[model samples]
Structures are given as C-alpha cells and as structure tokens.
Target: MILDVSALLSGKVDVLEFDYIIPLLDEEGEATILPPPDVDFTSGIHICGRITDNAGYMALKASCEIGYRTACARCLTDLEGTFCYEFEKIAAKAGTIEGDEDNYVMITEGRLDLDRDVAEEVSLEFPTRFLCSEECLGLCPKCGKNRNLEPCDCANQKEIDPRLAILQKLLENQ
Candidate 1:
C-alpha cells in the first residue's frame, strides 16, 4: 500500500488516519509475496494507525496483525500463530535525514511505500526459532527419530567420545 503524505508535507493536514489491508500473496497464485523464511501468511495484514507531522517531519504509529503458519524448529511439526506488533517510525523527505538508516524511512515524491516497511517489521517480529511446545522432546540424533512420539533403541547405547580412546586403552592395560 502507498500512502500519500503530500498533505502532511505541505502542512495542509496535521494528521492522517489510515486503515488498510496488505496482501501477503499474489491474488492469482498461492505463493507468498514477501515474508520471513518458512512462514506462510494465511491472511492479509490488517493495519490501523495514524501519521502526524512533527515539525516538518512525518511521524507514524501503527499496529498490525496477520495469521501465519510455520514449522517447529526442533520437531518439525506444523504450527499456526499470529504475527502482531506495534511500530513507530519517523520519515523524512528523501535525503533529509542522516546517519542510521533504520531509524526512519525516506519518503519519495511525497509518498511512502508501506509494502517494504510492513515486510521488514513482520520479519523482525517473527521468532528466530519455533517450538511446538516449551517441553518438546525433539528428535533423536543417533537414529533420527522423533522422540516425542516413540522410544528408540539408540537411546540405550552408550556414546564414547573419540578423543578419549587413548585413555580407554591405558585403563585396559592396567
């Protein structure tokens, strides 16, 4: 979605209330457009916020939510969750602000493109690791099986570190 900030830029409007929907995928296809890795956005993002002119600079405050599906990082089970967050940003006319790029966005042609910002915010808010539950048993390294579902014989085997083989030989000689 594109927001025209000409009125705010020109000082004609001090504040603008906005409510819009950002589509997660192309309308014609099932593929995701722009989302964090392994995440499937199941619904359009709903955003509601307001933009105000702060001494010639545009300040934005918004809250958004979207339904998403992903897999558990440990057990690889499908999980569903909602991505939600509230954000604030200061946008200046292109080339006006300096230093950190993440502090604010650059407005071009008196318009702010929300697509990139929304995607970035969603990615930042997404969890780096997902778990089906706090106490998930995860998978067995020896037999590559899900330990939560069933027990594996590999769990009964003792694993010896290869680096300690010399010590084992010394003990056997004694």
Candidate 2:
C-alpha cells in the first residue's frame, strides 16, 4: 500500500486521511506474533489516522488497535483484550529539515509505503508486556506456583552465594 503524498508535500493538501487493516498473518495463514501458538490475531491489526501538512513537514499520526486472546506475560492467567496504541511520526523529504534522520520516516520520491511504515511504527510503539494487572503476583520461580492464587514462602528465603553457604551452614549448626 503505497501512498502518494505528493499533494501534501506540495502544500496543496492540508491533510491526508487513512484507515485500513493489516492481516496479522504470514503467507501460510499463521499468526504473526507466535510461540504461545494460541494467541488469536484473527481480527488483524487496524491502523487509522491522518497525515497533516504542517507548516514545514508532514506529520503522520495514527493509532493501532490489536485484539488478541492470550495468557498473562508473568502469570499464565487467560485473558483477552483490544489494545490501542497511539503514535506520531514525522515524514520529511531529504535535506529539508536538519538533525537526526532516524527521527523521521524519510519520504522518498514523494511516495511512502503506508503499510510497511505503519507496521513498523505499530511494532515499535506497542507495549510488549500484557499483564492482567499492574500489581499481579506472578508465579514463584522456585515452586512454580501462581503467587496470586497460592501464596508461598519460597520467596522469603534469601539465596546465598556458594562462598557464603559455608557461613550459613556454620550459623545453622550454632
């Protein structure tokens, strides 16, 4: 999906609006973000926003919405949600604005690959961690029990270094 931003670059168009979805699947129909192998990305990733012809540069601002069914990152609790992430990326032609080139999505020959560009932005801007709650007690590392469901004392014991284990043994004997 290549977008012709020529008009916006020429200062003839004030804004260019866009709304579309990118299927979160590869050629084989498998989901994009995988490994859990159960995450539901059937609805695909939706991107909707506008490109404003600012006084000097074009501002590409958009929001990405992802709906998925998966387990919590820390605890293995099942959950589902529609997450929205908002981001703004500058689109400028070569040598017009000065500074770091990486800051802006470089406009090449007045054309922009909207699909690829927006997808990159979505991946970079979206949150990787999907938690059930801010203070969710995850599973205990030693006991492999869900701390939220089953409280454990495994977290209370302090791990001693091998060199310090001798001192701990001496204290225990005393």
Candidate 3:
C-alpha cells in the first residue's frame, strides 16, 4: 500500500503510524515466492510501524510478522510458527539525498510505498532450512528408514582399503 506522508512532510505532523496487512500474492494475485508444500502462506503478513520526521529526514521503523506451517528439512516434521522481520530506512524527498542513495528510501510526491521493501526484506529472511531439533538423527542412508523413529541393524562401519589386508591379518594374528 502507498501511504501519503503529506502532513508529516509539510511539518503538520511529526509522526505517521501505519498498521495493516499485506497479501502474500503479487500484482497479479499470484505468488512471486513459493514455499514448500509443508509450509503454508495463506494467512498473509501483518505489518505495524511508525515514520518519524527527524527534522530534515524521516526515520522509518517497521516490523512484519508472518504465520507459517513449516516442516523439518530432514524428517519432514510439521511445525506451526510465526516469523518477524524488522526494517529501518531513512526517507528524504525525491532527489534530496546524495551519494549512498541505495541505503535510503526516497519519498516521491509525499508518499511511501513499503510493499516492495517489506516483501524483499521478508523474502530474504525466509527460512531455507528447518530442523526438528539440533540433534536430529535424520534418515538412514542404507535402508531408507528414519533412524530416530527406530533402531536399524545395518552395518554402520566404514570400509577400509583392500591394500591394507595384510595389516588386518597381522592385527588379527596378534
């Protein structure tokens, strides 16, 4: 959504607050970033923040939270959680800021469009890997079984080089 900052920009207001929800879809009502089947993105994202006019420039502090149904990467265990991201940017009238323009969000026509910025920051912070626990046993490579679910009798030893057969024989004789 595009927010009008006319009052704040004109010195009529010192701060502008915003609270709203942004759909997870793109301009065409479809997703630009898709999560795995185990992760749900239907609930959308909630954002709340304020823009303070710090005399010459506006300081934007915003936070967004998204609800998700996730799964472990190794075991595929379902999980329900909410993830939050915080964004801060300096805003100045269009063409006012000089040099490092990339670090600031330039306001054009007394308006602020946070949709693109929020989408980008949230997408970058999205989880690429999920785990049920820190010490997840994962799945067994041999029998294609979940080692954490049950014990397997498969050999867990590593094979030695055949060139060391004489050393094995000597050790056995000892």
Candidate 4:
C-alpha cells in the first residue's frame, strides 16, 4: 500500500506493486453512480528512480492505468473509462517543498501512499461530463422523461408571449 521513500534516499531502493478494490463513497458515505460503487485498481510501480542526496527528495516516474465506471451526465447511462497517466514526481516531506508546489508529492513520515496517490490522479483525470453518445437526446424537462427513448415535441415547441397572441395567429395564417 505504501513504500518508504526514505530507503531510496539512503540508496536502499524498494518497489511497490499492488492490486485492490477501492470503494467510492460520497460525503454521506453513500455509494454514488457518478463514479460507480466499487472499482478494481491495479498498480505496478517501480520506485527505482533517484533520490537526490542534497535535498533528501525522490524524483520518480510512474506509469499507471486506472479503470472505473461513471454515469453519463446527460443520458444517465453507466460508462466505463480507463485513465492512463504517466507522470514524473518529485516526492518529499510535506513541509520541505518551498516554492514549486506542482513539482512535489508529499510523503508522510517518508512513506508514499501509492493507492491514495493513484486514486487522486485517476479521479482528477475523469472527464467533467460523460455522454452516452455525441447525439444523445437528453431527458425532457416537462414530463421528466428520457428523450432518447421517446421523442417529445414539447421541448421543440416555440413559446409565444400572451400579448403577442393576435400577432402569432396572423403569422400562423401566413
């Protein structure tokens, strides 16, 4: 679950390889279909990259693929997508990184929690919106029905002001 980067700092390198199912719980500890309920996350990482002696920091490159299910924002259909991210991390203790926050990964007590890190990165990679299809017809507002399943004319009707009723009739006849 975690690897001590302190060992790498001392030239005693160690690697972390793990596969596990992580629960996606909401603020109320309830399961959300937005990210599905449970997901299997497998990670095979080699932390063999160098730990700078002068700074007692690690510069490691990680390549990982995380798969999860997310409901389409428009169609409310379950869709699965894999997030593949390869990034270089300069890991150090939380308080050590001064100016460049983007270049650092915080290790608590010299231990890097790979599971948490992978989840964070993968979650961040998720698209802001998921669509079942590019031409998907969304739900209807008036009847609260899925337009994709059944087409509705209510959503396509043009609204006219009450004051323009007489003018609308004249236009309709024309």
Most accurate candidate by lDDT? 1
Q: What tens-digit string does per-residue lDDT give for candidate 2 at 44-70?
A: 678888889869667889888878777
Q: What is the TM-score of each candidate against the true structure?
A: 0.68, 0.63, 0.76, 0.49
Tens digits of per-residue lDDT for model 3 on 16-130?
9999888788679887446655678756778899999878678989899888887766656776788888888887788887788756776889888877777777877888767
What is the C-alpha lDDT profile of model 4 across 51-163, one tens digit per residue? 34334445666665555566666657676766566667777777877897766778788677655555566566655666778777666555546778988775466874555
Error of 4 at 86 (Å): 3.9
Model 2 alpha-carbon drift over 4 Å, by segment? 25-40, 94-99, 135-174
User: Model 4 residue 79 lDDT?
Assistant: 69
Candidate 4's TM-score reads 0.49
RMSD of candidate 3 to the true fold? 7.7
Lowest summed lDDT over 10 consecutive residues: which window, candidate 4? Answer: 41-50
Pairwise TM-score winner, candidates 2 and 3: 3
Query: Which lDDT values do the candidates have, in the order given?
Result: 0.76, 0.71, 0.75, 0.56
Top candidate (TM-score): 3
User: What is the RMSD, in Å, between candidate 2 and the native fold over all Cα?
Assistant: 7.1
Residues 27-136, model 1: lDDT tens digits: 66654346678877788888889888878767888898888889887778899988788898887878977788786867899898776677677767867667888877
- Candidate 1: give the clashing pairs: none
